[model samples]
Target: MSNADTILVTGGLGYIGSHVVLELMEEGHSVVVFDNGSNASRDVIDSVSRLAAGKGRVDLFEGDITEPAQMDKVFQEYSAISTVIHCAGLKSVAESEREPDLYRAVNVTGTSHLLSAMERAGVKHFIFSSSATVYGNSAILPMLETAPLSPQSQYGKNKVEIEKNLHAWQKKNGGIVVVLRYFNPIGAHKSGLLGDRPKKEAANLLPAILETVSGKRPELTIYGGYNTPDGTGIRDYIHVVDLARGHLQALKYEPDNDGVYIFNLGLGKGYSTQQVVDAFIQETGLTIKQRRGQRREGDVDACYADNTRALQQLNWKPEYQLNDMLSHAWLSHKSSLM
Candidate 1:
């Protein structure tokens, strides 16, 4: 928790990790980033280094998580590491369906490898970047942490498996482990230095909206036009900065009688696909063409979060609303293109 605490952030060059790294540096913590850069670029690291302004140093480890030797090298170099924020995993539902083998190899096997390395290195604190997909197609409107998990995609199943593995690991090791089951994380850092950098084509809505606004893509497709008030699928979209701050707070939490904790990070409000498109148009004053398409293969009707537990436990809550999310995302999008 000190300024000198060497924290290992896997996938630190990615969208979510870069924001979290900035937050960690702001809190005066030293970070070592371990990313394969398969889905990221060296430019992101350069951007982060510039954002840090020499206040924090980021040591990059470019290697796949499935490789044990690569992970071992990180532990060997940074033996003083006390906490790890594991964010290094493939996270596309459509892609996972196309390549289940890759998902199992990276999400499942890669997580196991990281756990083993952390255990061997004596790192106690662990924070897992889990997903809302674990509670797939929930009958509950705003899904709670205790909601029954029925993951619809391989990516969701991977997250469920990882959370279970973390539980088992905690039971044997007696260390503090926090699993943050996040909703749709949108937006970029307010500084415009970090944002979502998808390697392949983006499946998420915000990035697609940005593409439409930037004239890279034409006509945003509104999948499924028979769901809710707007006749489109609704989702809980949390700002990336707020989500990153939640991770920092999770790291600060002490074990509550039990050593493990799980909390959902979201805005506790739902936004339909049409609503998002409308918001983007309103924010950017750009005419975004739209096409009504069929529902995505693994799409769900609606899912937000009962963020009360996160507020109670981690003393964390999102400050940005939908408008703020849209504005910040637009800022990052414009900045990146420039």
Candidate 2:
């Protein structure tokens, strides 16, 4: 298979998906972005196009992956989309608990719907946007891809279910499937053009912290009481751009490589929530008022990654440091407001 397949990115305007679109364009891959326009906008199309600068072709379609007819239309129009990066899903843990049915419908059933569309379209290569949340409240430190399949939250359960379903689908149909169990994806494209935002508001950590810096909120709240030394949860946060590049790597994965390839996308080191806040303050010389609170349910004390598999298998390594993540994320936050 050629590396230049016209790749279709579901939720293409989303934070991680947009960054991957830019990377694909930079690498001269023909790209098509399919979005529901729920969590993102047409503005991202312009940003990605500008980044591409005629290096490649980019086409956009306002659609949702959950709808088979909509995805079928996308497939019909873009028959050249031989590969897909599935990123469309409901992602909030709290929201998932409130509406497990929705999460299941979107993340699991919706994904199954997408896989069916792919099979019909004869698109054999797939990359799924999974989360480390699948590990969920584990006793393990620095999780490996081989970690247990016990997820605690509804959101995480959704990811785990879809991963299992994908494994089953791969076994039956046979294709190149890559499951990327991503840790916390912070930062943004180094160009400051993309950042995370849901259809409604921000719930992720770095975005919440940045919002506080913008004075959109009064203060940052650190959920404390975890078993970690800082009394807050620790996570391995990878730069969004680095995580995005991993998708491109998966796309370039050898066609002969059959079966499911799983990799944990992270920095292989953990940082507490407090540490992230302090890093932000240090990076920008900004004072952030933060208070500790009780640990939320389904919380883990520390969860990093054992990313040796990704490095050795994908021939890719995370390049940005904590400082780079802090600064670049802040810049992207500012850019989003502008």
Candidate 3:
């Protein structure tokens, strides 16, 4: 695709999607951000604008993917759009367990609506925001793209269902479809202008740690008694910025044949919860109150990634290390307090 191509980013105001939008704009592509004003701040665009610095054009649209008419209207309005980076979805695993049907409607049925709209608009390129949760709590140490999918949570199930639909959709309609199975995305933009919204209750690890250090939470619970070296669950944490760049690489990738292309976005290593907490304290010299809690049911001992395919195929590699991720995240979280 040329730099002139208009790229539509669903959930573009979101944490990860906002970073992807910044990356695309910095690369000089016109961006049309479609979001429903759910779980996002409109002021995020101001930060994106400051970072983009007139590299490309950006337009924001308020619409829900679950609404077919809204999806169709965006496609029809932006008739010149050639590709889509879908990042909108309800992502809380605990919440999904409570509302499985809600997850299905937004993550599954909503994606179907978007696909139909794309079909009508004649758009052929798509980049989906998938998660490593699709692999479930496998005993496998490092997960690969071809691993058997056994999603345990409703969120993971939603991603697996979407992947299956994308495969079938590609076979029948013929399109360049890329599925990115993200392991664990953490961190924020270097400028501290963009990051996860400061919430008293955070679902992810990094945010929880940041919140505790910033005194938002009383103490960070370190779920323990896992079958790992540190007795804590280990995960593959990739910087959000790195994950955003991976999408840009996906946009440039050309498939060898007519099938869905899937890749894992991760740091290709594991870090225990205790290790992450220690890293945060060491990197930022901040105190994080902590407590020990029993491991959550269905929790895996270790989960990382086998990023060889992403490295060899997309020519993509992560630049930040664990320290960089922690430092940048702290900077962003600290800036939010000001």
Candidate 4:
């Protein structure tokens, strides 16, 4: 995609999407934001606009992705849109478990609507925001692109299902679709102008840690304490900005390599929960209370990313480390509290 090409980012006002929008504008690409405002706020658009220095307008459409007519309207207005970074969907695993129907409707059916709309509009270059949850509990320490698919939750199953549908679409139409299987994404934009603002309580570890530091919660609950060296859950936490850059790389991907090309976006290292808590406490010097608890249902003992495919194909590697992730997150959280 060229700097002049208009990129339509679905859910562009959300955590990752907002950052991706900022990155795209920094690269001189015009961005049109398509969000339903279901889980995002309008304040993000104002922040994005201010950050971009008004170089680009965050044209937003407030409508559900499941509505074909709404998506069609977006395509109609922005006919020159050659690329789409699909970041829109219901993402909570617990919520998906509670409402499998809602997950299916938004994730699976919503993706179908976007792809169908793209096909009708003759826009092919697609970047799908997938998750590492598709790997479930893998025996492989660091998951690879070829790892077996075993989703533990409805959210994971929904991502897998959408990936399959995208592959099918690519087969019929000669379109380049890059499915980015992201590991646990943490941290905020370095600017702190944009970050995750979950409508309800957060399920992610970093947010929970921030909440503990902010004193919103009484104590941090260490879910598991009998696994591996740390006796806590380990995850490959990639910075949100790095994950956003990976999407830009995916969009520029060529079409000769058609079908769904999967890349694991991560740092190739895992951090245990206790390790993360220690890092946050050490970095911020905050007295974060903690409690050990039994492992939650469907929680994995450990998981990280091989990340070789992304390095080789996209020439992308995480520039930040665990300390950097913690520090940045602490800074953002502290700023918000102030």
**lDDT for each candidate structure:** 0.88, 0.87, 0.89, 0.86
lDDT digits (tens) for residues 130-243 of candidate 4: 999999888987999899999988899999999999989999887788899999888887777778777668878888888887788999998875467978988998999899
> Would you estimate the TM-scores of all the predictions?
0.96, 0.96, 0.96, 0.95
Instruction: Candidate 2: give the clashing pairs.
Output: none
lDDT of 3: 0.89
Candidate with best lDDT:
3
lDDT of 3 by residue, 224-269 (tens): 9988888998899999999999999999998777578999999999
* Tens-place lDDT digits, model 1, residues 1-338: 23358888999989999888888877777888999988888787788778878776677778878999899888888777789999999988888999999999999999999999888887878999999999998887789999999998999999999999999999988889999999999999887768987887887899888777677787788897556887898899999999999999998898556577989999999988888889878888888888999877777889899999999989997899989888999888878877
**Model 3: residues with Cα > 4 Å off, grouped in runs:** 1-4, 198-200
lDDT of 1 at 277: 88
Q: How many residue pairs collide in each prediction?
A: 0, 0, 0, 0
Compared with the true structure, model 2 gives a TM-score of: 0.96
Order the candidates by lDDT, highest first: 3, 1, 2, 4
Report lDDT (Cα) of residue 205, candidate 2. Answer: 93
Q: Considering summed lDDT, which 10 consecutive residues are worst modelled in model 2?
A: 1-10
Residue 17 shift from truth in candidate 1, angstroms:
0.4
